[model samples]
Structures are given as structure tokens and as C-alpha cells.
Target chain A: MSTFRRRRKTPCGLLSGLLGVIAMATVAAQEGPGLGETPSPEMLAAWDIDIGPDGSGLPAGSGTAAVGETLYMTNCFACHGPEGEGLLNDRLAGGHGSLASEAPRKTVGSYWPYATTVFDYVRRAMPYLMPQSLTNDEVYALTAYLLYINGIVARDEVMDAETLPDVEMPNRDSFVIAYPRR
Target chain B: MSTPEFPEEEHEQVAGNGLLHRRLFLSQGAALLSAGSLGLMTARPAAAQALDPWLLTPGLALSGYGERSPFEADVARTVLPVAGTTGSGASRTPLESLEGIITPNGLFFERHHAGIPEIDPERHQLLIHGLVERPLVFSMEALSRYPMESRIQFLECSGNSRPNLASTPPQESCGFLHGTVSCSEWTGIPLSILLDEAGVSSEASWLLAEGADAAAMTRSVPLAKAMDDALIALYQNGERIRPSNGYPMRLFLPGYEGNACIKWLRRIKLTSGPQMTREETSKYTDLQRDGRSLQFTFDMDVKSVITSPSFGLALNGPGLYQISGIAWTGAGRIRRVEVSADGGQTWAEAALSDPVLPKALTRFRMAWRYDGGAATIVSRATDEAGNVQPLRSDFMAANGPQVSYHNNSTQAWAIDSDGAVSNVYV
Candidate 1:
């Protein structure tokens, strides 16, 4: 947390220094027409919704799996099955060790590499019928329920910004990046 | 040596199964009629010709936005919405019915995660933040101020030619099976200039690009690519981009998979590592035969398909026909495209058309003299990087049958004795 704070602060100091250096160096030659405006924090907050694997940009909200289950039944059960076995939409749970099988069922527990993506995707594009309608707390509960159903978390465990980032997913170590190889 | 008095045989086979030489058209255009080998210019009984009604009458006046001929009503994109969703699917370009390399703006293939968002360019703003000394936001008017460059490039969905992976060939048209790829002239500002203006931090290695659509389609692109040749494309095919193809602006990464070019591009945040977004991790990744999926497989490998004389495009008692097709490579220009009349047993080089630009579709043609026998014709393209389109068996062996993305194998079209064409595994 201290490192994150320091990293964030260093950019501002560096930016001020960059302004002076850029004025002398004429960095505008490389940069295109300087017409872009510096976005305010509130403007940034409205559109900056992406959550990285390390829990960056995760909103402040908490929900337990028990609460998540109720939210799931009400919001997600129509498309995603009751236990996330999948019906009209994507299956969100189970398929823990099926990646190597003849017919791999790539559900959340099976192929996804990060737990934060569960929260990120559910918050942004879930329910299929009406997306981006869930509250941050409701999104947290739904994500918690999915994790619990996938057997990655306990039923009573609380999922928030702090604890969600620490949930080590099953397929976290299975990915192999194919670009910019050394 | 003295010139021979006798004319050379116009129908001489260059390769197995009646594959004529590339110069057959030039050498025997006038002679083909006298020899009666090609039925293209046979003499017919002269009769009094009647003028058509349109020739005698005045044509309709032009409209604000001109449209194609009403006679060409059937030549439209094949829309395939997902079973449960309205707009969360793809529409294929009509490859077999079209000619030349440039896909018309309207007929361009579309793959949307959510429905096309109705974005007012006046209201939309692009934000560039994270791992940068200066976080900047550019509106449409501001973005247009920057100098731009245009290049003719091809964008292909990794899932194009997916039907070729099946054990038995699918009896579908070339467009239906492999129409998710299209080429266009994209004009846009270079992303490197924007990144430079934003003062990218040296620690950043990846960029998370997000769209403004309901799905908020997101993908992580390597920073090196952004600094190399990525574009903030606003105009496509000499006009403002269509709404289905990301109207206001889109991230156009030349030669990369189509999905990575986020439509309705709204945000680009620099990061130290990949965000492992849903599209990259779970959807677009290539699952191999060993059950290990290959992530960040951006390059859409070398591929080719014979659009004409393919399935559903039957020949009329084939005497002479020009086998035309489009060949492309994600790495660079297509160096060579070879057509096979005998289904890969023998190969003959096809004549590439003019303006063979890098990362753009190259049109290839081969003259053929059919003997009215059953035959399988296929095209094989080799890119500047020397990457040849893999054989079907070889490609299938590398990636299992279940894998859907990045199928760039050679496609074969079987011509029966009745001059009927059908998709076949040769």
C-alpha cells in the first residue's frame, strides 16, 4: 500500500519536472498537436472502471458469499444457471480440472487466471438483459457468490477490495504470454 | 533459335490437372476464339438488338448518400446474432460475391461483443492515463487536429476459416466460412505520438484498451506494438467510420487480430503487466492440442482463399476460367501465392495484381483449362516472412479440433464433373 502511494506521488513530481524539460527540449515535435486537456479526478473516476489482476481500480465495497448467493438468484439466475452450470449464457463456476480433458469446460474455476476479472466483468457486463445496473456492493456480492460456487472461496468469507485481490485462483499460474518474447 | 512457324498450343497444361500457365491469357486471347478451346468469344448469330427501357429513360437522381444498385440486393452481409443475445455476434462479409481487395464500408465484417453504441462524437472523449507523467483527455475535435496517415491494411478475426478445422468439410460458401476478414484504407493519428504526448513511464510494458460499449470490451496490448504502428483510426475507406465499425475512433493495430482493435475506443491505460482481461484470457486465446491455451496470440498468420469458383459458384461446362482469390498475411506482404488444380499434388504460381501493399490483401489469378473432370483446387500463400499457410492436416495436428481461433489453413474447393463446386477436404 505504501509502495502504491509512493508510486502515485512520484508521477506528479516527475510530471512537473517533465514540463520544464519538455519546454527546453521541444518534445512537442515528437508529440502531436498539443490539444489534449488534463482530465479532472472526477471525470477520470466516472470512466475508469477497469480492474487489473493486482486489484487496481477495484471499488470500495464488501459482501459475503451468503449475501452474494441471494443477489445471484435474483439477478443472474435467468441467464447463468442457479449453480452457474450455464444455460442461455456462460457458465461461471465448476470445471476446476478440465483444461487437459478431451472436452474441456472452461468455466471460472477451470481456465480464468485472475479472481479480479470475475469482479471486473460481472460489474461491467453481467445480467445480459440489463448490464451495469448492479451497485458496487451488489457486484461484490455476485462476484463472491461466483467464487464460492466455483469452490475458490468459503461461503462465509467476505470479499472486498483487500480480500478479493488475495484470492489466488486455480488457473493463475497456467497462462503463457505469447507476445514481445525475449 | 529461329521463331517457330506453328503457334504454340494455347491450352498447354502448366501443372497437373489442367492448370494453365499464368501468361495464358496474354498469349492466347485472340487465338482462343479461332482454336475454339475457350468458349468465351464464340461467334453467335447476329440479330436486331433492342434497347433496354433504362437506356431510353432517364435514370434516378442521386441521393445525399449514394447506395449500391437495387439489382445487387442479394449481395449483402450474412448477419449471425448469438442465440440468446440480439447484438452480441458477428456479421460476415460476402467474400465470394465481391471482387478486388477493398471491402466496401457497408459490407465490411463486424464482430460486436455488445450492440453498436450510439456515440455522439461531440460527447465522446478518449482518456490516456496510468503509468504516465501526464494524463490527457482528447475529444473528437482535438484528435482531428493531429496529423494523420492512411494505409491500406487487412483486419482479420482470428476465428476466420474456423470451419476448416472440422473433420469433414462444411458445405458452406467461402464467405460464410471465411468472411470474417476484410481489408480497408484506414486514416488515423499514430498512437506513438499520443503516447509520447502523454509522457509514458518507462515501467509500462502493456496497455489496457477499453471500449465505451455496454460490454466495455477490454484487451491488453503490448506497449511495443503501441509504440510501433498502432493507430487511432477515425476514418475508414475514405469516410468517417461506420457505427458498426467504431464510428468516432478505434484502436487500429495493423496486422493484429480483429478483437484487439477495440471499437468505440475510450480509454488506454498503461500498466506494468497485462490486465488479463476476459477477451484475452478466456475468449481469444488459442487452446492447443495439449490443452494449454496460448494467450496474447495477436498476429493473424498467413492465409488465402479462392473466393470465386469456391462453393456455390458453379462453372458452366468449364472451358476456360480465371481462378481469382485474395491472399493476405499479418506479418507482411504476401510474397507469393501458388494455386493447385490437383489438390496440392502439383503447384503453379498465380499472377499477383498491382498495388501489393504490406498487410493488405493481394489479389491472385490463375488461368485454367478444365477438361470437365472432377478436381480439387486450392490456394497456398507465402508471406514476406516466409510463413506459408499450413496444410489442413498440419494445422489441425498443431491445434486440436475443438480450438476455434487462428485457423489459417489452406482451403480446398472441389469441382465435380458436372461443373458444380463444393467445399471438400482434399
Candidate 2:
């Protein structure tokens, strides 16, 4: 118990209140809805995923910033922005000089470390439900479109195999190397 | 309280909101059995029993074929409840309630940030481009012909834990905390063969895996791990891989973090290094003591905990309850599991479900009897490499505040006099 988080000072009350307080604390700490309770362990393997910075999870599908413009305008525009600018969906890109600035801005071009990740997320779990329902081509295009909307890619630039990975994200070096070995 | 052992005793209650108990939703017609034939007077009993008529849908004996779970009586779920913000994703599977190794494929639990996709396995081709001398596209059939191997393994989501999942009375089932991990005998082609076919370029240091699932789930795995023990799985548990288990194909990185195993996999692009994504950056990274985040810490460090005799269970005077649960690790295999009814104060080795394959969920059981007083039950697992699971206290002391992900800390359950079980962090 010593190593556990130091117990907060108990609220002042009667002596008998202590047992009730502990019981209540224990009750509150049940910590789970305790549903099926079967560790299944089998299902665990089914739900894991990794979305890369470059959006590696992006499917074979492709999409364009224009189509992304239409999709964004319809579904995401309300949350992201009119043209991927900072708004409800947060900044899609930019913040070029905000890395070390006081107000650290997390934009696609400035803070995002990889382009594959944008594709991965957009495909794997995006639009939330109906996840991965988008055609692979659509994900690639949406990735391209998002990049383009962030001013990272040119409007007419076809975002496909040849151009996708080469699209250097601003945070390429923004992230320090993880998994360092001694 | 002496209810005999027949699954038909299955509880059938639908909460006002439509979140079936995960399993209850499976046999929708199971409860439609007429009690009049069984000589029961109550209509409620008739509404909850499985009749011989329903099991004949595809027949109880599934010869040379896989069948959807006959036990999904309570699990007619579309998606997990989204309880406002502060939540990333959480989904529950039917575990404690499930029997046997192979969980019905469709009833398999899913946790997608985006959504599931519909792929025409024919039009869907896995493109192995980038940093490869020969960029090849293998149709699902072509890949199936490659040297195939099968594995009984478990995949565990890094963030699947219930350390702070509640502020109410404890949940009465074990599935909530441990259901995020499951095991399956997945058969697939060796990625090494595919990479060899693609003729990976020498400069290729990282291999990026992508899935068709929305969120276009992607992750950058080291080329070494990629070529070492990776798989391009095509089938799971003797059937064509279920659409959710990546269907046409998925990249299975054995014994590594679950996210690295891309589902609905469609492509593999060899690259230079870790491509930090939202999963690698904004989430999944462990914030350590010195304000540093732990990354690339891949192998689910060998850990195990008893799942049964866990929270939300009723003691029923505890004469002899089988203390059983799962133990596993991304590091090789589980060597041994020890259970303690007294919270590790004393210990005894538990029997492991045999063929304890590497990177798989090894089930373990030990008979435990309660002295009829307040008591704590805990289980610890040791892997083949001799890595032992740490105690909750030890974990708390070393790790400090736990993160939302990768918590394999030892779990304990305390039984009260009233026969209620709750999570015990001790």
C-alpha cells in the first residue's frame, strides 16, 4: 500500500463512516462493466491496428483533393474546415512556423510526421463507422486530397503509387527516432 | 442456486437500450422455443429456451464447414456505445460465455476507428510496391498457393484494459477486462515468400502494412520483424478468413503489437524507417516518468492474469470453483502460470491448456476453494523466456500512473461476504 498512490485525506466524518467509505471506494473501483467476462483472447487479435503517419493503412483505392473537397465539403467540412483550413475538424494543414512557437499548432504539413498515417487512419477507422468501407482508391485520393488541401500536394497532382510516398511530410524529422537500441 | 450445467440456462434480458449482452444477440430464435412442449407454464421460460427446431437451421453438426455461433443469443450488436468524448474506441467480445477455441467468425468483436469495408476479393489485389525490385500484385488465390502455415495465436489490443473503466458497482463478468485478447488458428502464406517474390530492395529498412478497413489502418514495422515472423494470413480457424479478420488478407505480425497486424490487408510497401502515425504518436505511446514516451516497445512483454474468479463473479459459498483464465506474451510462449487465492501471498502452479503455442493465448486452470471469508484471487504467468508478470503494487510502483494502452498488469478480484466480486488493485 505504501507504493500505491498516497491515499487522499479522507473527508472529515464519523468513525463508522470509515468502513462505508472504504466499501464505497471499493464499489466505485470495480473498474469494469464486467460483461462477457471471457478473456476470449481470440477476439483480441482481431481488433488491433496501426495507422502510419503516411497513412500506410491506405487501401488500394485512390481519391483526389477535389473529391476530398466534395466529401470534406459535405461530411468533414463542418468539422475540419471550408477548404481544410483550421475550423471544427481542426487544422488540416499549415502551422509551418508553430513547431517551437508558443501556441504549438498541430497541422498536417507542420506537425504530422508522415503521410502514410493520414491514409492509414482515413481507411482503417475514418468516417468512423462504415470504416474501411471506402474504396482503396478513395482512401488514397482522400489522403492526396487532404494533403493537397493542406497545401502539401498540388491540385492536379495525381496521388498514386509514384507520388504518394514521395510527398514529404513536414514532421518527417519532427518526430524523434523511437525504438532506440543500446 | 443448484442450476445444472446447460447453456440454455442462458440469461435472456435485453436492457432498455438494445445493447444485447454480446452473446444473447446470437441465437435470436434460440429463445423462441415453446414452453408448452416442455410442460412449462410460464411464457417467459418458453421465450428463453433453445428449441430443437432452430439448431436445424444449418444442423448442429457443421461438417467441413464453419458456422456462425449458436451462442450469439445476446450479441446482436452493430457497434459499441460511444459515451461522449474522452473515448477513443472500445468493443467487447463474448468470452467467458463462449466455449471451445474457435469463436464464431461473424460474432468476433471489432474495434475500428473508421468502419468496415466491403471488398470484392476478386478485384482486391495486394500490391507489393515501393523499394522492391519487382512490384507484384497477388490476387487472393495466387497468394493462397504460397507455402502455407497455420498458427493458434492470440491478438491483444494494446489499450485493452479496465484500470479506470468505472465509477459504479463492479461488472459481474470477466469478459470486459480480458475480452480484448483472443486466439485463433490463422492459416496464411509466409510474408517472407511474398517479399522474396517481390524481391525486396536491399535499402528497404521499413515495411509499411495497410488494410482496407476504413481508417485505412497503416503501421510501419521494422523490415527484420517483417521478414522474420510475419504472415500474409488468408484463412482463420479453418475457413476463408472472415471479412472482419481481414477477409481477403491481412498482415499478421506474430507476437508483436496487435496494431501491426493490418486487417483487410491489401498492400505492403517497403520503406526506410518507422512512419509515425496517429497510432504511434498521438496515441499508443506510453508516457514514462521523465516525460518521455515509450515507443517501438513492440513485443507484448510476457504477462498473464487469471480471467475467471475475476471481477463480477458470484462466490456461491466457494466450495470448489475452478480458477481458470488466460496467460500469454508476444515474447515467445507462456512457460508457466501460478494462481494465488490469497493475492500472491501464496502460490500454486496452474495447468495450462496444452499445445501452448507461441504468441497464443494459453488457458490455465487451478482448483481454488474459499475459506468462506473476504479473500483475494490473483494469477501470475511466466513465459518461456522466464519473464514473470508483475504484481499490481509492483506495477504501480514502477510504472507510476498507468496509460490507457499496453497495461498487462496483474489483476485481482476480491470476494465479499455477500458473494459479490470486484476488482482489487492490490
In order of appearance, the predictions have TM-scores of 0.91, 0.66
Predicted candidate 1 versus true structure: per-residue lDDT over B1-426, tens digit per residue: 111122456556788887877765445442442243323223344674887698998999979999888878988888998768889899999999888899999999999988999999999999999999999999999888786889999999998887777778889988999999999999999899889889999999999999989899999999999999999999999999989999799999999999999999999999999998889888888766666778898998899999978888777675667788999988889999999999899999987877899999999888776778998999999999889998887777776645888889889999998878899875
Give model 2's DockQ, 2 decimals.
0.10
DockQ-based CAPRI category assigned to the predicted complex of candidate 1: acceptable
* lDDT tens digits by residue: candidate 2, A10-127: 4665643575457546642211111111223343233334444444433344567777666666656655667667663457766766545434455666656667767656655666
> What tens-digit string does per-residue lDDT give for candidate 2 at B33-128?
211112111123445566677667774564785545555466432245333312235555656555434555655656654445678988777777
Instruction: Give the CA lDDT, 0 to 100, for residue A90 in model 1.
Output: 83
lDDT of 1 by residue, A108-133 (tens): 88888888998899888877767789
- Give the DockQ (2 decimals) of all models: 0.38, 0.10
Model 2 misplaced stretches (Cα beyond 4 Å)? A1-182, B1-72, B75-90, B99-104, B162-172, B400-402
**TM-score, chain B only, every model?**
0.93, 0.80
**Fnat, one value per model:** 0.67, 0.23
lDDT of each: 0.85, 0.62
True contacts kept of 1: 0.67
